[model samples]
Target: MTKQINLPFDDSGCGWYAALAPRPDVKRLQGRQQADYAVIGAGFAGLAAARRLAERLPEARILLVDAQRAGFGASGRNSGFVIDLPHKFALEHPDPAHKQRLLRLNRAAIGQLQGLVEKHRIDCQWSHAGKYQGAVGPRGQAYLDHFERLLGELGEPFRRAGREELKAVLGTGHYSDAIFTPGCYLMQPAALVTGLARSLPPNVELLEESPIRRLERDGQGGWILHGDEGSIATPTLLLGTSIFTQEFGYLRNRLLPVMTFASWTRPLTDAELARYGGQLDWGLTPADHAGTTVRMTRDRRLIIRNTYKHVPRYGRSTSDAMREQVRARHRGAFLARFPQLADVPFSHTWGGVYAISRNFTNFFGELDQGVYATACDNGVGAAWGTISGTLLADRAIGAGSEQLRDIEAVTGMPSRNPPEPFLGIGVRSRIQLAAWSSRSEL
Candidate 1:
């Protein structure tokens, strides 16, 4: 049996989900349930996968299960940018052709998500206002220059903004330089995921607050997923559980669970909003990977996200004390950027988990007979994860396309990581070095 040691639970300090209305009672799995296909985890990937599978196999009974309510985990805790270009921190490839393929895939995801939001009339405050990649010091500027070169090579249009222009647009002089790329979208991530779950096809049954505790093979060619109150049997299993996939006895030592924290301030008063002379809503990504990400919500709240920790213990390591320390860092970063709103208090703070691979490749294929998975999306889970999950459904049914081949060619396989203590030491040290190098940007 594959035993799960950790699970995705609600982080009460998540402002994204807290800002929304309460959900109705969850339908947890009970007794013996059967599904033709089971898609685990209700985040971006699982939702897309289940939706796609349901679309193709209209007669199939598909189960989409999650440990907590939809959008209460990493999916909702993100900085909420649906980026359309290759991420700066993703594995670097010198081939422009490879980069172009990635760009196309990400854009395709954006288009797919846009269609659903419009069709369902999801009220997620969706925006196509673009995003700003900013630099605070010389090191960050150098990274931004590299990013600009990559953008140019990909034939993507971008506008450069210096200090004064950035200040005028963002209402802060903290950023020395920035590039505005007009293809990205912004929205409340939690709302998007929850809406997607609610709007799934009639054939898919979504079970929330049902944590799969263990997995064991059935006597036949199927598998049995054991939960606290019930079990599920399915001939086909697809896991989109992010880092938690390791607990199911696959992809061991091939993925890293990185913890990142964010803090959101209370809604700005009319006077405070006037004092902050920037656009009403805007998102800024740091040129340095370790720097801070800042955003102004449509509802007039400011969000500050930064800091990384390699927590092998997963959620067990994110204690209240640790969250408090991270929140303090966020407060410092927020004050540095918006000192005019010195009295603006943070209303929520939380830490989230996302998986990355040593070689920057996600697992997106069959793990064993009758089993498949799509995990480790690096940091671009919003777009890449969505597209990958959609394609994974197609691949599971023996379907093929040029897009599938392109993604497979570029994302070969996740490289194996070192064992235990060594791996922890290396990752933690690297994180510290990166943070130090990007200190000014933070």
Candidate 2:
């Protein structure tokens, strides 16, 4: 039976850290403000960009705005995996040079994340156990074979895991072939975003609940952005609005609105461990979303969702019913893979909206002279978000950023906008197909 997704905003859906933390209310902007640059969206991308901007331009007045509280958007309520899939695999860009640049940028982004975690003394439970992608049957195996060949051609550092080796790593016989890589990292995503937002350089002003009504361009190549309570006029703008930016002028047609959901398990105590294979470490794309990622929270709760999508999942909400169904499906997999935790009372689940482009690339460029955006991370990864932010800040400060220029050269994949209305039907059908296929043999 299809489950209903009602409470998409509930805390349980965001996994452990977000659930444990206090839900900070969104603070509405009251009147007026002025800054050198205005940044919208408090997610990882926006927050990180704001931080770097402060570092580069210590004296530049920065205004950060979000529709909700800091980390309340996708950044706070995500799987929080710090994995970076080279553009070659996830993106259809055939340019090996572009792929290499992506690899370097991602590597640098991960290093930046690590440095921030250490510098801030943030307790986000960071780890670098890497990640595994397994194919349980023929269909999945075919993709694995193709992926392995690509890996070989790319000369990426990777290994193929046979059935026995896969079993040893995952403690399961559910997979036939696997691909192992060392770029994936895991963390408490909400904590990381919230931690970063909390320690702004004391110069960046964060305004939450400040829904931008519209950004009116002035004659002087500046913008007058207004919120319900306040407004700001700035010569420059940084649009961190991932999915919602499309609501504006040029960005509307640029971003493809997409929704992805994740389900988290109730925390598992010690006795539960001894009863099963003691599932530790983390696994991603346990099923079809070989592109998405999955893993276990620090408290040993299973987070079964790299991301779930249909043909036309527009907007930024998830179904409560679907989230519960995901938990049930994960429970079944847990029983099959490690029977010990089947009975754990499933406590929490959550979902969020991630923006994507038709070509699976993100929007990161100076849309206008002063306005810029960095969004569309199809994968539940933070590397892109971090990279986007740094690039945005670099542009905002007039600093020379070669990485940004190189990426800008390759425009996002030609967008294939979903047909309105029926688009949902298409996405829904694809998701259902993948789910059914995961259950049955290849």
Candidate 3:
């Protein structure tokens, strides 16, 4: 069944992605169009797929359609952190083998991302300094303990830092312990997406300010996507829209798209740089119940955000509650993390919606013949999206192997059910309790 969810991009006047935009403009689609494959949504999944598909099928005609400008969706607005660490340890699992295999897959995916960005010369400010997730206080220490053990057990290359080392790296007295993982990297997300969008070979046609209003099965064994400019007919169709609102009826409940809000401070002044650190650090987020993710803009501003998870809230009509709560968290979060910069003024605050799936991971595979789908990155896309796009493209070219068919993700990488519905509520609520119980004085 097609979902009846609302598209958010039509509402929000601006998104977090506007900060470092590529500003690449493509010609709009007009009249009737036909192609070997029609890919919808120009975010990572669609663009990635389009890029690879061209490399594999040089002769095939490809068309990538987007509701807005390419890379203008969550792809441009995300924290831009290339998640290196493993997905958090699961509360329910049969054996450690599945987790181990996933770690290997994650490593391969990370390697592939690094290789692709470098080979393609993608200028998304890819850096591999790793991430320092600060664990402060007694409770915070224990929380880091669980994650550390999970990585070690899964044989992930990780190192835990004591209070002294943590202070050395973070220059903060608030944190008690920390875990550094190499699997994650920082990215200039919009730049990366825009770079890829512009790199699409001339063969792949792109459309902007166009949306698929309806999909009708044609008598000729193809799907016709009705757009404002015109209709596109293709033998194969790929749905890259992360959250299928009521508009896309195929998936109403299968995917959860959540909107996350963020505010980027103006470039840090020299005084502010010295206050935090005199280096271009990737980003630092404290380990708390409502932990906020922070990163440096190429210009150096503290980008802070944390609100809403595992559901679809993107584009135009993001809730006021999500924005207010995130702003509140940012105000108090900085004070608790660094009393040194409590007076810094925020430059901008905006929100964007990203997709999450049943497994809290991106899912890819054929839904039916001639209709292959991919999406639901949870909060982790960027690198993973690149991984997914490349894999799907290879499959289309018949070069993909079953062993590489890891897209049939575990039923619940995070939880089988909706995180908020029951599974998420259960796990996150406990995590919150533990976080609260562990803090010294919030």
Candidate 4:
């Protein structure tokens, strides 16, 4: 059996969270309560699930619970790219149909999020800036060529650019070539999530800092969730807790928790901006999977994300030593790309968790009686989480739709991982090997 989850909260500040203005305080779950439906984990997916449920069943008493404040976990800590393209490795799947399904789902997710942002008038610095898949060297360039080929097969539009074009757009000569895909949006993740949580329908109750300790089926055909301060009983439950779902022993070894680190520099001064001339705000993903991800924010801050580790447990925080090591790596990557900004230092450094599967798939559906789940984002959390949550809610309510079918067909449950100790060892070894191989790109 999987061990119980002790939800981890990162004390190190997230630049995105710090950038946002203070939000009004939210209430925490106290004492026992009963609801018609309970949605665990108030990240992107849980928020979407609870909102959809509220819209579909206006009278239903829906409870949305989170271990920490809304947007304070992986949802707020991400690099804030709502991508509409398949992951670089996703194209490697032999089935072209699978790739197409992925593209459709990703686009659908982007559409859903766009609608919410517009309807609610979210002020999260949302922008349709698209993104660049940049290549650092020959190997990275080859990866870009493969991506372009895949894009062509999918009939997607992209602009191929060489060193000069990339330099003009990114203000750096680090990348040799790149493909610009115009379907991604950049935003302030923390603000977006918190806004979404606040905007949830009146039928839903938002409860933060309520970590579920255990969940079990009640004898009366309902579910009981035990948390630190209180418990909740509901006839139906939807879980969007990502890797923390292991507490239910649902996917167990199949879902792996990989932690990635990111850091953000303070806004550049006018002179610094002039020295680093380029488009004011842009985002770039690396052609190499293990390479660094860079984003120039609308507020003139530069963010860098790279490095990965396997961490199954939640409460254990990233050590100061590891933070320093990753910080050094980020510094090196930033200087390599923008030598002129070598003196600028990062204002904040933080880590986020991603639930990955060996087959690069997701787990969505009813895992048990009256218990539904949508998780395992495979490193693309923002979009995947949104769509999965919406679809899962539809499934729970017995509402059939083409999108749900597509998601089910494309993203079956992840394959089971190897047993315990060996599984951890293998995952760590793979991460180390990949990091070592991508040293130059870093």
User: Candidate 4 regions off by >4 Å?
Assistant: 1-3, 315-317
On the 0 to 100 scale, the lDDT of residue 243 in model 4 is 90
Q: What does candidate 2's lDDT look like per residue over 1-442, in tens digits?
A: 1111211133334554446467555556777787888898888788878888888888988888887677666787776667666743353458777777777677778999899899998777788877777777787777777777777767877887888876665656767777888887888877788778877897898887677777787778898887777888899888776766666565555555555666666666777655545357675554345333456666677666534654123332445576667666656555655565667665665666766665676667777778887767765447888887887788777677678776565436437565666656766676667666655422
Model 3 agreement with the true structure over 309-384: per-residue lDDT tens digits: 4333344444567566667766775566567877787665667776555555556666656777666676667755
Instruction: Provide the overall lDDT of each model, using Cα atoms, as 2-decimal numbers.
Output: 0.90, 0.68, 0.66, 0.87
Largest TM-score belongs to which candidate? Answer: 1
Q: State the lDDT at 160 in candidate 2.
A: 76
Better of 3 and 4 by TM-score: 4
For candidate 1, write residues 43-154 as lDDT tens digits.
9999999999999999999999999889998888899999998886552678877888888889999999999999999988899989999999998899889888877777
lDDT of 2: 0.68
Q: Best-fitting candidate, measured by lDDT? A: 1
- State, as a TM-score between 0 and 1, how close model 1 is to the true structure: 0.98
Clash number for each model:
0, 14, 26, 0
TM-score of every prediction relative to native? 0.98, 0.88, 0.86, 0.97
Between prediction 2 and prediction 3, which has the larger lDDT?
Answer: 2
Residue 137 of candidate 3: its Cα lDDT? 73
Please provide, for model 4 over 1-442, each residue's C-alpha lDDT reduced to its tens digit, 9 standing for 90 to 100.
Answer: 1235557556556888888788788788899999999999998899999999999999999999998899889998899999987786776777888888888998998888889899999988889999999898888888888998889888889998899988887889888899999999999999999989988999999998888878877888898898888989999999999898877778877888888999989999998988888776799988888999999988899889998988767427467888889889888888888899988889998898878998877889998889999988988889989999998999999999988988998878788899989998999999999988887677
